[model samples]
Target: MGLLDNVKSKLSPAKDKVSHLAQKHEDKIQHGLDRTAHAVDKKTKGKYSDRIQSGTGKAKHAMDRLAHKDDDGGSMSPPPAGGATPPPPAS
Candidate 1:
């Protein structure tokens, strides 16, 4: 098997498990995201309110998609691009 295929096969079960968990605990996940965003906003003293709000919205949307996986248990929805908002974490 190709390298990608082999890795995918090995990780398939784990991925499915995560998808199931996400679906089951979607509310908890969203709450955590909100908490994180709130903490960051507090730390920044609202200086980046607009940017932070935009980023938090994107993050919540992405988490919502993950929590509602498709029939194949894969994430098919694409997240909203941040555009000029907070840049994504560097790889």
Candidate 2:
């Protein structure tokens, strides 16, 4: 396999584990993200409130995607329309 494929193969197991954990503790993870964002916003005295909020939203979205929350029954979602190959089916 090519270098990128080799690296991906090595990391796939870790990625699946992380996805499982994220699915299991999704609520806690989201709460932590919100709390951290609030603290950072407070520290900056709202100077970057908009940017902070945007980033928090993006993080939460990523977390949901990782957790497969957007898919039915927690199955993997289809690949994006950008012509990338989908991940292999979970064993």
In Å, residue 80's CA in model 2 sits off its true spot by 16
- In the range 11-72, model 1's lDDT, one tens digit per residue, is 98997788789889877876777677767877777777678778777776766676666843
lDDT of 1 at 27: 79
Native-vs-model 1 lDDT? 0.70
RMSD of each: 7.3, 12.3
lDDT of all the models against the reference?
0.70, 0.72
lDDT of 2 at 57: 70
Please write out the lDDT profile of model 2 over residues 1-91, one tens digit for every residue. 8999999999989989998999999989988877787777777777777787777777776777788844666565553332211222233
